[model samples]
Target: MTATPGTLVLAGTPIGDLADAPPRLATELASADVVAAEDTRRLHRLTQALGVRPAGRVVSYFEGNETARTPELVEALAGGARVLLVTDAGMPSVSDPGYRLVAAAVERDIKVTAVPGPSAVLTALALSGLPVDRFCFEGFPPRKAGERLSRLKEVAGERRTLVYFEAPHRLDDTLAAMAEVFGPDRRAAVCRELTKTYEEIKRGPLGDLAVWAADGVRGEITVVVEGAPDPTPGDLDAGELVRRVRVREEAGERRKEAIAAVAAQAGLPKREVFDAVVAAKNAAHGAPSEGKGLT
Candidate 1:
């Protein structure tokens, strides 16, 4: 790494309204020694809107060229080039291409930062009406049905709300798989063309949303799903609950949700399942239950 004063700055463009662009973004675009954009034409339009003309070099840094361009951008940073990274919309390196360059810059002891702007992730998340304390962002599920189903299987028992970016074309199938895996009654929201003209937010059970998507919609889409509820032992089938707990544990569910789902299904409280699990363990070790004599 060559000695340089330059830093890598990721600037978020607006997800919709051009006015949502942060003032600092325009300053960065104008002052940087280089601006790497996912789409140079879009960047030009944005720059024009801000009345800021870049005195720096502008290069296309998209998926197809990101791997090849990271090294060169790192070299520029080493030579004191103030490189500004921007995507077509939202932050770079978030299901975007700036991650590789950011990682490389850190490895070289180069400074890295961001010019925070609008994000569809937080925007849709805040509007989701689901638990906000904890959540995960799944960029996009695979386009293929089998692959998407397999991916949904991995997150079946996740307790935190989940967010996903998806193409409008595959929205129907993606939602169908979600309903199948997460249960038809799970709550979710479909946010489309957010912050733009004709913005629409549809909130309902996953099953209903799947049918709506089949009608064919357009524009960018963000999906938010509610987390799984806590478990109750009495809601479970004694034997089935225990078996499900084991199978789910192996498949990646926390001991708690597996137990909870079993309890819920059996119409029992969670404590009962917890006690049963403990008793089963003790029996496996040849230990007699103290309650046996009392009964």
Candidate 2:
């Protein structure tokens, strides 16, 4: 009889509280034939805390070694070994490892599944008090200010609530940059040490949060920012549209691109914005304002 192929199980570990580790997680940890973890040391601690002895051959599987280890893990799976993949916290392949291995397993026709558990992204979003009905998880901003700002600029106009993971040390600067790009008045929440004893959620305008974080915070941090507000018809006036276009231009957007962005934000056509600019220029130059023009 042909033996059934093995399965790849991506289990979610507790983000903080040990009790959050589901019974299925424990069972999977104890029964899998091969267990791969981001940090074997952390895995050992988790197993000890849960009083579970993994009956599998434990191996290290993290970002640095994932590429090299994936093929090996896939081979084990092909040999009918049930492979359990876990990260230090939360679900794997989410800003973590296990994605490459899972992709490899799928290519070989091996079954792949996940054990749902606590997610910091969802946790922060829920507590953020922002609109969670529609949201996007942007895991970790770039460490460098320039790259980070460039990244932020790309999402400045996103209407869906935005979520991001940030290092405590960089929290202040990141918030400040966010305030600069997304606007100081933009509402946001900074959730730190989530699900832990000292868990704290700071909610306020980005500018205020930047000032507060200047003192420094500690622990796993997740930030959720409210989406840009919908533009009302009154906001599309020529002068308002011009100001919006200027804001984009100041952010390094090309004139044409800025006009398009302004038009989208104001719910106006690009031609309308172009005409507004031309008319404003003509009025300033004491030229005809309403005749057939460039736009």
Candidate 3:
């Protein structure tokens, strides 16, 4: 006879204030048969703060060993061990290290559940004063400058609000890149040390925020950027379209990407924008127009 598959519990830890830890988190931490933590030291501090001692074995399950340890944890689940996974703060898988274990557990038909607690994503979004009805959590931008700019460009025309997790040190460069790609006038919010004693939410245009972060920011950071604004009908003229494309190109975007981004912002077809750009170029170079003009 096969043994009953055990459950995998993903518990959310407090982002800052220990008081934010949910009661269910402590109970699960105390009762789980096996506890996996991103940082064993932090986990010890957490348990101590909550006055809960694990009745089961505790182990480290961080980025370095996540791959190797996943199978071992999965095997334990198959053998009916209750495994609880927790990160240093917030949910395990959101820019953290629980995705592999969760995916592995799901593959083995193991029961998986979550103890929802404080979330930096939602907290920052709520405090951002930006549209929260529709949004996407982009996690973290690429660390390298070129990759980071490329990533920002991909979302240059996203209609829904965007949320991202970034390290304190890179906040300035990231915000500057955002300003360049999303436009300096785009509204955004930077949430720092969320739920902590020094919690701060800086709200302003991307250009201003970029300047503000130049002096450096400290603590956990969550950035909320307003979505691309819908262009008015009057704003879709041929000259305007061409100018928008040029702006992107000037900011290091490829001509193709610039055209696509302009098209997305105008809610027009790419072909239409391409034709407008072609017509503008033809007119400038004293050549005959090869395509239809902007309507």
Candidate 4:
């Protein structure tokens, strides 16, 4: 018996416009041996738009079905089925389902690939006018006040731009939490209904944005935040550096990242940062280097 070649295509459909669907996505959908979609109805709508009926089996692989569908999908992939995964918008597994399937495929050494599509991250980042060279995506923060604050505290000193997807109803509370945790002066932009007619970008300090969102805004929302400002050079001091680094490190930042951040803020080289960290470690153990400090 001949073995079939197995492949997993991670396809991207438009977040809005049907015309935005990439050619590869349509072709893959038309020929896939198994189409795993977040929503079968939306998939049908998409197929209708492309005028291409999938000539393969279709399966719903949404949040509710994700856990139950994985083993079955894995078995099919092991049998060399060309499983194509598509979500309702943008890409799958990003604030959606498909991560588990992707993880399973990787565990079994199955090939995985993507068909590029629209993203609220890039769209909001582009429109936010905030620095985007480096960024971190936080997805949606916790809905409850305490949990949300705890989460925000985790990224309080993040120097890279931050992106967040928020719901219309929670906009005010989320923005308020961001202001309190990230500081009222933090620069941020609120992007709503991207790629749609009512698309809007509100840019200002977090305090102002919080107030605006409090009045209630509708449609899809994407938020972009400017990173923490780098402290000026020559502000070196072991005290503040240790405080900042230890705070963030305790909040979940990796040691290496914490050191780098302290280095950036102290206007010190990474080597200097490393030396400071070592000295602090030594001090904690009653071995502070007497020669390392200023003469």
Candidate 5:
């Protein structure tokens, strides 16, 4: 007879305050047969803080060795080992490690569960004062300036509130890029060191935030920016509509979907945006006007 596969627990660690740790986290940690941690040293601190010693072996499972370590963890889980996975902060696999291990365990028919706990994303969003009804969590912007700007441009017309994580060193540059791409007057909030002693939430326009960050900021940062304003049909000219469609296409979006998205943003019918794109294509080819059906 085959042994039952052990469970895989994805535990959420506090972003800053140790008190934010969930009650179940300690129980799971103490009972787990194997504990995979992003940083072993941090794990030691956390276990000490909770005053609960892990009953099983602890191993490092971070980005550096996530790929190599995933198979090993899965094998242990297959052998009926209750494995607990934890990151330094927040939940694992949200711009962190543990995705590989979770996926592998699931593929092997192992039970995978999560311990609901603190999240910097939700915490920052709630404190942002921006629209929490609709939002998107954009993990982190690219490191390179050109790539970062390109990434920002792709979502320049996003209607949902945007959230992003940024390193302290790059916060200024990132905000500057956002000011340029999303416009200087766009309202935004910068959450620093959430739930920690030095926690700060700066709310202002993108331009102001950029200027403030120029002087320097510290701690883990989460930025929340207001969504793009919905423009009326008359607000966007045919050339601008075509340009928006082209931008989306360049960003790997299907032309049809791109046209529909631009139409929604401009609050116009999809047919209108499709016509504009068709007209622009014909004009670029120097072709005479011929009524073309929307594809």
Candidate 6:
């Protein structure tokens, strides 16, 4: 005889304040048939603080062992055991672990659902002065400088606000790189500590933020960068395109690369931009003395 399948619960825990822990989370913790937590010790502390006792088994489900433990959790679900998945903070499977188990559960046609709670991404975006009507979450940047810069370059022309998760220690270097690629004047926000007592939010140009972060930052970090500004009338004129390409070339980008980047940024075809630059040079034109688009 086949056993009844159980529900897979993806619960979001408080990022900082314990009071933010939802009552539903408490009830779920107390009654779940199996609790799969990213950190068993942290889970213990949380349960203690909440004054709740689990009626079923509790197991560690983190990055290290998630691969091997997913099947076991799936079996529990298949056996009709209520499996509750919770991360250290925020929602599971978001720059955290839980993807494997959730995917397995879905493959088996087991019911999967989430208990909505506090989110760092949305919170930071809301606090950020930049526009958030359209945005994208770019998880962590690559650790290496070259790779990180390449990744940044890929989105250089992105018009939607960008959100990123970065380690505190690497904040300065990351901001510096962003300033280089995204321009020193690009606006951004640095959200730290979140809902904790020491929570802090820093908003300014990327260049200024880089200098501030150089002094050192602590706790969790989320960065929100304003998207590339929209081009205005005459923004794509031949003189404007030449100036844009030259600025990039002066920044050490190859001529070809600079032309391509300028094209993308101005929403123009590369051939048109390249021809414009060639035409400007042939006409003995140097950088524009003054123009609405030069800055």
The candidate that wins on TM-score is 5
lDDT of 1 by residue, 111-146 (tens): 999999999999999998998999999899998899
**Residue pairs whose backbone atoms clash in candidate 5:** none
Clash totals, every prediction: 16, 0, 0, 0, 0, 0
Order the numbered candidates by TM-score, best leading: 5, 4, 3, 2, 1, 6
Kindly report which residue stretches of model 5 are placed more than 4 angstroms away from their true locations once superposed.
237-240, 246-254, 280-291
Error of 6 at 267 (Å): 3.6
Q: Which pairs clash in model 4?
A: none
For candidate 1, the lDDT comes to: 0.87
Q: Candidate 4 has what TM-score?
A: 0.84
Q: How big is the RMSD of model 2?
A: 5.8
Model 5 local distance difference test score: 0.93
Clashing residue pairs in candidate 2, if any?
Answer: none
Please report, as a residue range, the 10-residue window in candidate 1 with the lowest summed lDDT: 286-295
By TM-score, the better pick of 3 and 5 is: 5
Candidate 3: give the clashing pairs.
none
lDDT of 2 at 142: 99
Across residues 1-295, which tens digit of lDDT does each residue of candidate 5 receive?
8888999999999999999999999999999999999999999999999999999999999898999989898989998999999999999999999888878887888999999889999999999999999999999999999999988987887889999999999999999999999999999999999999999999999999999999999899999999999886788799878888998898799988998888989999998888888888889899865646656
Number of clashing pairs, model 3?
0
Tens-place lDDT digits, model 6, residues 1-295: 9999999999999888877887899899999999999999999988998999988899999999999999999999999999999999999999999889989999999999989888889999999988989999998999999999988977765789999999999999999999999999999999999999999999999999999999999999999999988865346578768877877787799888888888887877777777777777656865543322211
lDDT (Cα, tens digit) per residue for candidate 4, span 1-295: 7456488888887877778888888889878999999999999999999999999999999999899999899888889999999998888888989899999989988888888888878889989999878999999888888999878876776789999998999999999998988789999999988887777889999999999988899998889999877767656577656667778788798877887877876678776766766778789889955434321
Q: Candidate 6, overall lDDT?
A: 0.89
Q: What's the candidate order when arranged by decreasing lDDT?
A: 5, 3, 2, 6, 1, 4
Please say which candidate is ahead in TM-score: 4 or 6: 4
Give TM-scores for every candidate, taking all chains together and pairing residue i with residue i.
0.81, 0.82, 0.83, 0.84, 0.93, 0.81
